[model samples]
Target chain A: DAGVTQSPTHLIKTRGQQVTLRCSPISGHKSVSWYQQVLGQGPQFIFQYYEKEERGRGNFPDRFSARQFPNYSSELNVNALLLGDSALYLCASSLSTGEGYTFGSGTRLTVV
Target chain B: ELKVEQNPLFLSMQEGKNYTIYCNYSTTSDRLYWYRQDPGKSLESLFVLLSNGAVKQEGRLMASLDTKARLSTLHITAAVHDLSATYFCAVSWATSYGKLTFGQGTILTVHP
Candidate 1:
């Protein structure tokens, strides 16, 4: 079976621009979450969605947002990107809220 | 707020040596997870520790959880070059089981 898959493995954007990263969860998974991993640091939680509802959000600023689709796929959007926004965006999916998660290869975003 | 921390941000071990990575969290958690990430890659789930005194082993790696101490450990035995990677520990609280707060990661390098 396929694991979580993310689109556009790499992306480059300019400051003040916006970018949208997509994720397709594994089959039979109903929960999707987003995380940001800066170079030399561990991943940080961003947002989690279950049953297409926003279940939880992290300490990220309002510029970051995400939503899950009926199919359990998810999209992460970041507006007004800054140089600090250059990092790997990871998407994880699980069969339930507290179950083990499967992560995608992630989208490496670079903001200039 | 839940905070996770890992010591020895970097680990350099010789092949066939054994070592352990420690993860400490500040608040109560419903589950603990261990993940491995290769350079420029996403996370690979290694172990899921659900309860206090839970221990799981796969191949040369073992993970143990001590919820009473709010701590978890990942032990690696007979390390090999292929086992070199960054390891992360994440914790999810009962209130928001879908959101995982991760540690700072430990980068392990095994040399012959």
Candidate 2:
């Protein structure tokens, strides 16, 4: 069975630009969450969605937003990207809340 | 809010050695997860501890959770080069179900 999938694998953007990263959860999964991992650090939670509704948000700023679709897929959007936004954005999927999760390979965003 | 921390942020061990990584959380969540990530890859779930005294093992790795003490541990036996990676322990958010607070990660390097 295919695990969580994300694309594009890597991305590059200029400062003050906008970028969108996409994630397709595993079949039968209904919860999706986003995380940002900077170099030399562990991932920090961003947002979580269940059944197409926003459920939880992390300490990220208003420039970061995400939404889940009916199919349980999710999209993470970052507006006015800054050099500090360059990191691996990971998407994780689970059958429900407080369940085991599977993560995608993640989208590596580098802002110049 | 929950705070998760892992000790000894980095480890280097020779093959055939044994080591243990500790994870501590500030809150009273009963679930914890372990993950491994390569240099440029997303996280791979290693173990999930659901309750106090829960223990799970795979290959040369074992994980246990102690809810009373609010701690989890990952133990490695007979480590090999393939075991080199960053390991993270994450605690489940009680209210958000799928939301997780991750530890700082322990980078393990096993050499022959």
Candidate 3:
């Protein structure tokens, strides 16, 4: 079986630019979440979607948003990015709400 | 707010040494996860501890969780260079779906 997969393995953007990172959850998984991992720090929760509905959100600003599709795929969008937004954006999926997660290879975003 | 803390953020040890990394969370959570991430890469699931006193092992690494104490530990036995990576512990609250609060990660380096 295939694990969670993400696209655009690497991206480079400038301040005030917007970027989107995509994720395809493992088959039969209905929950998708997004996280940001800055260098030297742990991954921080950003948003979660389950059954195509928003389930939870983290302490991130409004500029960070995400959505889930009917097929259980997800996309994370960051608007008006700043240099500090440069980080690895990870997408994780689980079979259910309280199950263990499988993460994708993540997209490394560089904001200049 | 749920908070996860990890001890010995950076560990340097010789091969064949034994070490343990602790993860403590501030809230009650039934599901805990251990993940490994190499530099510039995404996370790899190592263990999923579902309840108190639960233990799971893969290769030379073992993970246990104590729900009553909201604590988990990842023990490395006879560490090898290939086992060197950043380990993170994550927890999910009962109400959240696919949302995980992660610790600051423990970076392990094994030398000969």
Candidate 4:
């Protein structure tokens, strides 16, 4: 079975620009979550969606937003990117919030 | 608000050595997860502990959770070069739909 898949393996953006990262969860999965991993640190939760509804959000600023589509795919959008926003954006999916999650090969975003 | 902290943020071990990494969280959680991530790669799920005293092992790694203490430990036995990577521990609340709070990863380097 295909695991979670993310688009644009790598990207470069200038400060103040906006970017969107996409993720397709594994087949049959209905829960998707987004995380941001800065260099030399662990991933921090951004948002989570279940059944195409916003289920939970982390402590991230309003500039970070996400949504899940009817198909269970997810999009993470970051606006007014700062150099600090350069990091690996990971997507994780699970059959449900009660189960273990599988992570996607994250999209590397470099905000210059 | 929840917070996770990992100790020995950096670890260097000789092949065949044994070591343990600790994860402590500031809030109650329903699940604890251990993940491994290679440089420039996404997370690889290792173990998920769902309850107090829950213990799960995979190959040379074992993870145990103590919910009362809000602590989890990942024990590495007979470490090898292939086991070298950054290990992270994350926790999620039952009502949050799997919104994870991750620890500062422990970078493990198993050398010969």
DockQ of every model listed? 0.94, 0.89, 0.88, 0.86
- Kindly indicate the candidate among 2 and 4 with the higher TM-score: 2
List candidate 3 stretches off by more than 4 Å. Answer: none
Predicted model with the maximum lDDT: 1
DockQ of 1: 0.94
Residue-level lDDT for A105 in candidate 4 = 100
Candidates' C-alpha lDDT = 0.94, 0.93, 0.92, 0.93
lDDT of 2: 0.93
Off by over 4 Å in 1: none
- Greater DockQ among 2 and 4 belongs to 2
Clashes of 2: 0
TM-score of each: 0.98, 0.98, 0.97, 0.96
Worst window of 10 by summed lDDT in candidate 3 chain B: B92-101
lDDT by residue for model 1 (A1-112), tens: 8899998999999999999999999999999999999999989889999999999998999999998888889999999999999999999999999899999999999999
TM-score of chain B of 2: 0.97
Report the C-alpha lDDT of model 3 over B61-104, residue by residue, as the tens digit.
Answer: 99999888888999999999999999999888777757888999
Off by over 4 Å in 2: none
Candidate 3 lDDT over residue span A1-112, tens digit each? 9989999999999999999999999999999989999999999989988899988899999999888988889999999999999999999998887888889999999999
All candidates: CA RMSD (Å): 0.9, 0.9, 1.1, 1.2
lDDT of 1 by residue, B1-112 (tens): 6689997799999999999999999988889999999998889999999999999999999999999999999999999999999999999888897898899999999999
